[model samples]
Target: MNSEFTIAIHSLALLAYRPDHMATSDMIAHNVCTHPARVRKVMAMLRKNGYVAAKEGTGGGFILKCDPEQVTLAEMYRLTSMGSVKPGWCSGDAEQDCMIACNMATVMDQLYAGAEKQMIDYFGQWTIRDVLEQVRREQEKKPGV
Candidate 1:
């Protein structure tokens, strides 16, 4: 659970709660208890992925670009990660593979690929709406006014 993933998901969930409203980075940072710059960077990535829309000038902020039900967690995770992970034990380099010649490498490769696939598949099964609903349920469970 990297901060990026948590922040991205939290941002998306917040946007989903108010799809038509543009939330400023400062507001989002306040909710996440992080710096505004970090929120802005995450917003940039979300905007680049077509997951969010930003407006400039007065009342400028970010809004959800698509329906929460249409946006899978996997897509959000992929956008946040920027496709950094590869589909093997090591990156695409012949020399590295040659140097680590052993069955362990092959086994590790399968394990890593499987883990990545599982993550994608799990997130793919849920949408931002699901996350928000879970939050709501947890809030309901709390004993407070």
Candidate 2:
């Protein structure tokens, strides 16, 4: 739901794609098509969560610490966008006397929460490794990736 989730997934997948499963933020940012600072922010969260380990100084970067097959998209969703599936604004004006306007926001909130749960459940079915495989398949379809 948020860019952070996608960036985290892409950064992790890039690490997994490499032979040693390690890379600097610059490399990840280039591969993910995002700015290096954005990559660093997401990488910091990933590192704090034990999914990655960072090293300091020259020739140092990040190393994938978790098994891709054991990490699900649902986990990333929870970490970055668990309650973000719902919109912050609703179409209703609670000050109005109309019953629908007074209750629309509440109803939409419930609906969005339920939908988020279902989406998270669906995301649970796909692991990081599955995502990597998807990337590989996409690359295979290209003439020269």
Instruction: Give all candidates' CA lDDT scores.
Output: 0.82, 0.91
**Taking the tens digit of each residue's C-alpha lDDT, what string does model 2 give over 1-145?**
9999999898888787773856889988998899999999999999999999999788889999999999999999999998998877788989999999999998999999999999999999999899999989988999977
For residue 110, give model 2's deviation from the true position in Å. Answer: 0.8
The residue-by-residue lDDT of candidate 1 on 1-145, one tens digit each, is 3577888889999988888788999999999999999999988988987888999889999998878888888887777663445532454344454655545456666776677788889899999899999999999999993
- Please give me the total number of clashing residue pairs in predicted model 2: 0
Query: By how many angstroms RMSD does model 1 differ from the true structure?
Result: 3.5
Collision pairs in model 2: none
The candidate that wins on lDDT is 2
TM-score of 1: 0.82
List candidate 2 segments past 4 Å from native: 19-21, 93-95
Cα displacement (angstroms), candidate 1, residue 5, comes to 1.5
* Top candidate by TM-score: 2
* lDDT of model 2 at position 91: 88
